[model samples]
Target: MPRPLWAGAISFGLVTIPVKIVSATEDHDVHFHRVHLADMGRVRTRKVCELDGEVVPQDESGKGYEIAKDQTVPVTDEELEKMPLPTAKAIEIAAFVDADTIDAVRISDSHYLAADGQVAAKPYTLLRKALERSSKVAVAKFAWHGRERLGLLRIREGAIVLHSMKWPDEVRDPQGLAPKVVEVGEEEIEQGLQLADRMTIENLSGFRAEYREVLEDIIAAKADGKPLPSPDEGGERKSGEVVDLMAALNASVKAAKESRGEDHGEEATVHEMRPAKRTGGRTAPAKKKTASSKTAAAKKTTARSTLAAKKRAGTKTAAKKRSAS
Candidate 1:
């Protein structure tokens, strides 16, 4: 079992469930250290005192808050620990709310809340089952790292998981970050929805960090003094601006369906562009063919046919006279 990072009790009204916080996730990313290129010597950072120009030991360093220029208030860990905070040693439940009500941006880290002892098992299971049945998450307050933090308690796989959350004030408002308003056709929106449906999956278990695997391979090759592996030849990266939005959406939908091995029944229909006038000015409505113009064209065709027939008769009469003579 993973070692617990913190030991605490959940103060759920009158019930107190002792629990241990263990990391719910793990990192598999490859880490690198700085080294000198000439001799491969490892480079390290040393903490130094700014005023005395002396290297400071880890134990000698303490937290300080800067109030003004060159003025700081030093704070010790003992002082912070002794502060009057109700959630100093326990996760005090504030309220229960629907899980969807909490914004995703406020959620930060996650940890598993395991029962600390046999006595805690009953209450832990009670809370887990209650949350599972009610389908609501518990919002709690806990003190960690010298400050009070907001947390969400929810059930996952019959175990209670605590997700650290940011305070409302800590989250920034996206006031002007949205794109400017633009016109979009109904067909384009429908195509976008179709693309989303095509790409939807049941869960995220199939995904893996392919970049990390390739990085590990590169490191192993370097350590074994072997040639680095060449990259696979894939399709060329698409570049340039998208001139036609509807066409792009149709292509995206088709690509997604093909990737998922779905049936390609029919092609996406695009809106037909209206015919416009070809002039050195603003586009005008296309001219319609009138009945008078059609009648005039028919008369010209008849006159041409009659002239051709008369010439043919005259040529035949001249040939007959020459033969008689």
Candidate 2:
């Protein structure tokens, strides 16, 4: 059980539902501390006052807004807490909109909006069910972490999930920062699509963060006083300027098909029926098969034959049993 970060009521018209906000996600990245390399001792940092050159205790610190190079306006925690803000203790519903209309880029963080108590459960359930039926989300405003935040409340897995959003001004425009546009030929585009089709997988879980696993292995080896293993060399990729796009795409499709235990030599019926582009007088080059592809095809053929043999044997045994009866 995790503790709630906030306890408040969600207000929409006359309806007020008390809810507890809990974090919906957690960090899994590896963290490291600063240490003295020679002595392997931990390193610590301290805050000191610039005026008196004295170390400042945590309690002595205060927030300040710098107006000029040497001028700062000090603000107290009590004064900030007493500031007028309607969303300080309540989530005010601003509007309702289709959940799909919300851009993923605007979402910052997510939190679970759970009913605070038994008294609030009925209203919470009502709200969740209504959102599900309408496929709508509530745009809301609330004060959290000492600042006003924009959020969206929607039903997720039978519970109300709140997604903190970034204001329009907070999101940076990529007009000038984006990559240079590259004009792609129709043949190149078709080949690229074909390669993508070959590499597509229904489940994303098939892939893992292999580098993290390698790092863990290295750590384990050090703890056990074993020699570190050599890093595996990655396949060489041709530079964009020198590479033949169509050839690369064809090779990639062939490799992908072989990895999936499919025949690389046999043309896929779909590809034959729907030629990506008309070659006119020129015919497309034959796919160049690698040694690995040949080995994969042979294994697949052997497996099919073995399965057919098993089926035939099972039928013969059943016929024998029927004759005996």
- Residue-level lDDT of model 1, residues 110-198, one tens digit each, is 99999999999999989998999999999999998899999999988988999999999999999899999998878777666766655
- Put down candidate 2 lDDT per residue, 56-91, tens digits, no spaces: 999999999999999999999888777799898899
TM-score per prediction, in order, is 0.79, 0.76
Candidate 2 Cα errors over 4 Å, as ranges = 178-182, 235-242, 263-325
| Candidate 1 local distance difference test against the native | 0.80
In candidate 2 the C-alpha lDDT for residue 241 amounts to 56
Score candidate 1 by TM-score against the native.
Answer: 0.79
lDDT of each: 0.80, 0.76
Candidate 1, which segments miss by more than 4 Å at Cα? 234-240, 263-325
Best by TM-score: 1
For model 2, how big is the CA root-mean-square deviation? 15.8
In the predicted model 1, the residue pairs found to clash are: none
